[model samples]
Target: MNFATRPNFEAISSAPVMQRARGTARIGTKQRDGKTCIDTLFQEGCGKIRLPRTHSSALEAVFINTAGGITGGDHLRWGADIAPEGRLVITTQACERSYRSTGDTAHVEADINVGADAHLDWLPQETILFEASKLDRRLTIRLDEGATLTAIEAVLLGRDAMGEEARDAQFSDTWRIFRGDRLIHAEATRLTGDGSERDGLSLLRGCRAFASILHVAPSADRAEQLLDRVRALHPAAGLIAASANGERLVIRAMARTGLALRKLLVPTLIELTGAGSLPRLWHL
Candidate 1:
């Protein structure tokens, strides 16, 4: 058969390559009428971000992933910049879902910048991982000397109410923060295993929900108070701990259900901060 007349073997060999989704979002603030205003926004591909109408003085941003969920080979990136003396809170429109993977791992990265005297709350919602999902995510933040950062992240191994369990999974998440080029926090959590493994149980004592809250430019008294509160409250049925390392305060919580974890985290943070205020979109 003539090469031209027949099927192009080389082209056919590559014709079925999976086309993964890619997205990027950028948000920035500016001074408007002597107040911090979100004046710059960008969205590309499947990622979109917008400022919601909020009664509070602080700027509120909500990120939307139009593709609905992430799977293997997908990539998403987000960046936010807060002007000097500005206050901003960032969150997702809903929980991010990671589906089962059949190929390469999904990737996500976030970059945040807070100017001098600025305050930022990086409070994105939880991420849910289904069985066999593969993912890697990283967050980097740069804060000016006087800036303050409050960030929270959570992960769920599957929906307990849905009767779904994630046993076969691979995930890694890392965070790095710097204040004026001086590193304040650098940490990573990695897990990988088959459908059944005793070692996985040791990772969390078989807990399905895990979360971490970190405050930079630290709060020792509040951290200690909250730690005592959590320990006093949940003497059993879950795990909660807190520690301070120099200028960073870290709190970690794990539970049998994702809701249980959130219940423990939200109230403690609010009680510590003296603000019942959370991301406007948060439910329970």
Candidate 2:
């Protein structure tokens, strides 16, 4: 064949398309015969919710991501609702992993509602960001004035044992909480590029692991009492701090490694959540 007439194979070749994951999981609880029971549950795609038998009065739920890890173009959503006088505790089966992204950004959203006199504990495990990973996550909670909520979100830049560091990664996290149409707490965090090298007074200060805890009670006095108890724990002197404003209590902690961060979180969470201990999945 003539060179000019021959087909250009290289020019016709195109990059293979990548598959993206999407999932949604929702659970709702109600008070039945003086016990919290599942009222509604929905799960699709890779998102899953498993109910593990617990001796406590509260209903327990564990979320799972069958996709293993999140990457570019992946989307996940979670939601929960608690009926009056019901109690619920939600946790993850394992730490969430955000792998490197080539294009776009991974997205995750969680919405929760608590009825009057209800209680909810949102305690997901740490989210590890791999090098070059990009993620956007948001959490929204709406509860009645008489309800209570205790939530914790933690993050790790990379695996300490593996000596991995998340360089050139991007992470954006936001939280909005409301009590009966009144906004009580709001937080937004954005980190781009190298997080480990950040040293600004308001930044991570060279820490690779960090966590935020929020507790909302029915009254200011209850929140103050919880804050006092947390203070009694003497959380990692310089690495942790707790404060209370009205009916909301906030705690922030940071450390050099995930293990260190957990050391500070475990006891503090136990006190704030009134759970006596963490979920079984947390130990695993």
Candidate 3:
């Protein structure tokens, strides 16, 4: 098979056990045999990364850095610099689980810089917090005038099938959005034992799974209206949504079970953004 010529970032590490054995390409993309590799280092481990360049269409990429099923601490940092006139999409292979942070809180930092007229989608799978685990995340995104971006963040409590509850867990996340050189949105959420019982009602509402999807576009009003329709479709306690500055749409959802919340959000996102279903890794 002939492969297109494109530039790829250099690989600096790998995990012998977690690495991808071979390479495969999906529809409408190029293939790089063994380009995806997973490696763990002394303080951190690197997961698979796919950076494919499409000539007639938008470029696409994926980065994996951690996992709970592998019995190792998980930490990941990824960023995409979409040159002007470039477009790209990103996703992961599975949900990241921050097991008990015996050493320090599991950390992840994502930075995205979308050039003028460029588009970027920073969509990864969900992240689960296990008993006594702690996570601190910071997402910083910058877009040039006329650039567009969509980002999704999902979180789950203790592993349900394992019967592990979040009674003793701690998690915190902070998100910041900027356009050009101004701050447009900033949010922070923390879950700890002290206020779990009280704040849970206002946030989790007895649900073990929660997710937020933010889509920013010039027609934010239309997006918000679309979110309103979705909220109206879901049961009152299952989902919620809100509008922002007529160009950004933020939707939040909670469910007694993980599957329940996903079922509610997937259709809404597909309808609103015209994007495909989330990656298979999120279900785990």
For this target, which candidate reaches the highest lDDT against the unseen true structure? 2
Let me know the TM-score candidate 3 reaches against the reference structure.
0.73
CA error at residue 88 for candidate 1, angstroms: 0.7
Per-residue lDDT for 84-169 in model 1, tens only?
Answer: 88888889999999999987899999999999888888888999999899999999999996787788889999888997768777
Q: For candidate 1, list the clashing residue pairs, or say none.
A: none
Residue pairs with colliding backbones in model 3 are 14-39, 15-38, 15-39, 47-64, 94-281, 220-247
TM-score of decoy 1: 0.88
lDDT of 3 by residue, 151-232 (tens): 7788778777887667667777889988899887788877775655524666666777888878777566665676577566
Error of 2 at 80 (Å): 0.7
Q: Give the poorly placed runs of model 3, Cα more than 4 Å off.
A: 1-47, 51-56, 66-75, 195-199, 220-225, 228-237, 274-284
Compose the digit string of candidate 2's lDDT tens values, residues 1-284: 65667777776676567899999999989888888999999999999999999998889999999999899999999999999888898999899999999978999999999999988889999999999899999999999868998899999988999998686779999999999899999999888785445566677888889999999978999889988899888544658999999999999999989998998888888886745668988884
Candidate 1 lDDT (Cα, 0 to 1): 0.82
Top-TM-score structure, candidate number: 2
- Model 3: ten consecutive residues of lowest lDDT: 34-43
Candidate 2's displacement at residue 1, Å, is 29
